[model samples]
Target chain A: MRLELETRGTRTDKGWRDHDGFVGPRQPGTGPRSDPRGDFPTGPEVGAAMPDLRCLTADGPAFDLHAHRAGRPAVFIFFRSAVW
Target chain B: MELQKSMRDFDAANIRVYALSYDEADALRDFRDAHGITYTLLSDPDSDAIRSFGILNTLIDPNDHPWYGIPYPGAVVVSAEGTITRKFFDNNLAVRAGPERLLWAALGEPVVEPLADQPAPLGVQVRVSLDGDHLAFTVQRDLVVRFDVPEGRHVYAAPAPQGSLAVDVTLDENDRLVQRPIVRPASEPHALAGTGESFQVHHGVFELRLPLAVNSFSRSAAPDITISGEVRWQCCDDEVCDPPASRRFELAVPVSGPPAHALRDSRAATLEPNAAAHFRRMSERRKDPG
Candidate 1:
């Protein structure tokens, strides 16, 4: 079976397992294209349109980013880990 | 945790703060209850929102990390028109932009000052606190020691075996105590600008894990023990290095007997994986001491 690994800015099928015992998917690298415009919009740039987001709140309530934003300045924080 | 404390400032500034995470609702709820977090926590178990924001951390190999889906740890300020106004992405993931930094980005200046309760010892803010809400004498505990340096200031990492003074932690010698400071090894090698001397230095806000244990206690009721220690380090900035200094801290830990049926917490937010593993090994070595 063929497996894919994304390491060192490229894709390869080198080692079966990483040092941490992880097996990556068998696929090509998904790096942003050199032609910046071709890259997927990961985040909305300054003055650019914000991406739509719909998710559940901690209380299990549906939350729409656009609805909450409501033409008001909003701050979004992405945390690394709560466990540590 | 810093965000949770200064939530009032965010609210008063007319800014709506939303916490985005890949954790499920249950885990987020547990975290909220445990930490008393009073913000809206948006759950994205599949990291859909994270990817949408282009903040998903793809550096980790998923096979090894069951909880690999995470953001790079950052904050973004968006305007009313659904456009990002300002963003802060830091190299140090452990210490991201706190309320102070975020307020700067949002308001274009420093609106809120540092809390007076946090004193700066040797021009560095040292915050020490126990991991959980309380400590139990039945098992070992962990303490989090955070050091925050001001703008343009830096602190030297622990020196080599034969090197001079650096950041170090030492507990007061006590027969009933088995304490060890589990400091993370610094791998970022920095070179002094002029002298070209290479040394490891920790900039901005960095944290240390301190492991403490209680050997024996005979108190029927809960007892409070003062854990005294000194954090020694040499502060420096781009200009010059200051004299070596030490900041003393006395943490009062309340220890009581275990409950009738105490259940282990398996949640990721409360579990320090590396520390737990190290503690397990230490316990095994103690049991098999030859």
Candidate 2:
């Protein structure tokens, strides 16, 4: 199954800038990639073999999506925030 | 949060659901405990997996959205054979896929819609009405309520200190409407007859009108909409004050087109004039801007 990933970290390439626009530390990268796909490996699309990726569980355990979904259907939901 | 509610349906379809977020394990645990979430929520603090998904939201300025490494909010359904079967995405950031919609996307079939006509009384001897002749789907309307306390008893008013309970009206979360609580000045300065302690209170019959703004509407062309919530307050007599009391209420109203027969009922129409006056005052307040 195709799964979208949700992001939470605040640090950009630039160290940290206040709302006032004062840049500090490293400058932030434009982060625009010519290719639409950033770093995901190719060939995890429909009718293709699912990619095996290692991700951390919310309870602090190393988990693999394919291993967890062993011989079963699964749905991955990527969302913003529960409280936001 | 709504996803957890449809876990049983997903399970019945042999489809397991997983939610990915940027929150750390500890924060996710706290969120799960607070909301009683039973599904598995994974952590992705660095957003490595999100970037790999090719759906990273790069359009948003990093400075403005530091903590949001959001993936265009969506879901993917995988077959038992590990092949991606379907995907769902929407451009609207404010609206998320509800449980029924998510299940529909996964199963490629229609899901049962939630029922919309449950109604019940919330407050004893209380009345509620809409201020306008016709409800507009895009404009804000007044929900006027008149609360009555039997003679010799009084209920605390706004700004009532921590020790006393104040009359409160809380609207349940709604997807179609944005609700704002009502604010009003207490009746003429007075104190309890026995305590002699100074406090603003509602006695006999008094009115409160709140604003409900329409954000988006359901497909139903009929203006009928049901609002559910609770009213909490405490009453005090000359001798003793009773413990705090609360009740659930469901108020259904016609939103557009023709008004229902109940709206024309003599008892219901009595509060419309007051609602109109309240609207006038509100408009004046907005214009003055002092």
Candidate 3:
């Protein structure tokens, strides 16, 4: 599985630029190689515990996936603002 | 969205539908009100959910414009226990999980059905025949279809505008033909062509012919060919067509030999009693509300 991380806005040539990042290389047998500036973190690092956040529904109920899972199953979806 | 409409018709309750986005609640509320959306639309303003799902686009173009950073649209079926049953995270935005297909998945029904109605909003059918062992024919090959439109109803001509009647037919798995059928009145509308036009007298009976190629068969030994496609058309009997509904049909055709060459015997035969009977039975139950 390909993994990605959220980098703070410092273009240092090593962190992911904009929001885009590449997962595993298309061709197999080739190990992942980071660029000189180290733009993207390796898959293992990015795959670490994902950050949990709160969501507000139209009904005004606040939801947090980590707390709501309660040892059960939950689906987290991310969508863009239609305004954009 | 039409997805909700399909879900309502599917009549299943086990799997829940939740649409999430990074938009704020106010934006989601506005969208819901504008579209009269009936499904749940959750807000993920901070991109946390988007990041967790790993669907966010983050690529920047050479022009310095950010092209990636949005979540890749997809659907995931989670079992009651929370395990992921199925996940589809492709980049195609227009494609979605069909209502019936989702129901079937939740119900643990077989992935393939022998008689799922091919949803075609348009009114056109193509027939093909297998000659010997090589070559296949398409509508361009002289295979003709005579649509028996119900009284007071008319099907539009080909090359229809988007969201208009545009029927298509293609051979499915397990299907092999000698010659593919062709369409007649190549340039004239169905109402104008008069010749090679067929009509339906009652509510159910409709007939069409298709030609096939000589070697349309796959290497499999099975004699069944799966016909899968969508139809986009309007059906109105002098008055109303419920909305332009896009229906999909997946059919399994048993290939024995080539369809008889004689015009009188050229009509494609319907499948006999099979699993389709079960579907019809279910439809019957739904129709009887009481």
Candidate 4:
């Protein structure tokens, strides 16, 4: 796992970079690799019941996943960020 | 985001969609208003939910500033009963699960797209089609190669009997395209009658799905990109195996514009006039909160 590289503090060459380019505290790739074999810890198993999620909505309302959806199918996504 | 484009299909299928991020709720609100995002956007500013899910990207150091506290981006599809039917967590930060793939996982079927009229090999039908009308950076869509093997016939699966070739799709070398390994259906075991040999084969109907996304760094402004590839297979029955066959395919796939995040750049901000303002506010808020 390339993730092991993260443990080596400030070891590798590539510094932080975003859309603006070459932006600090040294890391390896600074991002995920493209290999499909990377079986990163993907949370719960497929058949496992989804844990209830409690968080704030974009509108600042307290949102509860299971309660709001109420037995409906759902696609829950975890993304990097809206901001760069 | 590609999810916005597929909102209609998800709605039609009665599947609710929600995206969560570590950003503050206000930032997400601004993003939604700016991009006309129809689905729900959740906020986990403290990364509590991210940690609970066990997908928090541990790669970034504690003091990595804004890069820290982010999850390894992924999507999970929940059945009506709340079981996690499928999950797409790519190691690549740029690659994301296309909406069609999510819909397929939720629907428990292939999201079928009719292939353009083309002749098939004798007794076998091969159809290849893409899930979306266009290809975009990071958002993955399936390049589906379907095979309809005639009854009493089968195609060699991977590790095809030494000399035989497995049914597979190989895209020509293209720097613009990034592809994941082909998703093959479970191959059936075929037992030979005389020599006491057994091998894997696929009969009837099956598909080999190539999850493809455009490399964001390709930096092309063209309206369409030519995606060419070859499909090769050797069809065989109990007694006879046809010679290895291959057919080359070329598709002019339309190009989708840069993702919503790219709108923050001055050039792309023209698409949505408020993009730059929202981006400024978001970056300012997250900037070195010491």
Measured by DockQ, the strongest candidate is 4
**Cα lDDT listed for each candidate:** 0.59, 0.58, 0.40, 0.78
Q: Which of 1 and 4 is ahead in TM-score?
A: 4
Q: Lowest-lDDT window of 10 residues in candidate 4 chain B?
A: B112-121
Local lDDT at B241 for model 4: 90
Model 4 residue B26 distance off true place after TM-score fit, in angstroms: 1.1
What does candidate 4's lDDT look like per residue over B1-290, in tens digits? 67898999999988999999988887787778777899999999878899999988786665655566788889999999989999988765667888877888899875434345844345778888888788887788889898888779999999788888999999998867878778988998999999979999998778899988886656667878888999999999999998999889999999887664445466545545655565565455556555
- In the range B1-290, model 1's lDDT, one tens digit per residue, is 55675688878877788888766676577667766888788887667788777766555445324335666666788777777787765332323444654755676752224456865544787778865444543233556677777767777776632444677777776534545437454535677788887877777677766655453232235476677888888777767777778888887777554222112344531433343443343334334536
TM-score of chain A of 2: 0.41
Using TM-score as the yardstick, the better of models 2 and 4 is 4
TM-score of chain B of 4: 0.89
TM-score for each of the candidates: 0.44, 0.43, 0.37, 0.85
lDDT of 2 at B97: 43
Interface RMSD of each: 11.1, 12.7, 14.7, 4.7
Question: CA shift at B252, candidate 1, in angstroms?
Answer: 20
The parts of candidate 3 lying over 4 Å away from their true place are: A1-54, A64-84, B9-11, B60-68, B111-290
Better of 2 and 3 by TM-score: 2
Docking class of 4: acceptable
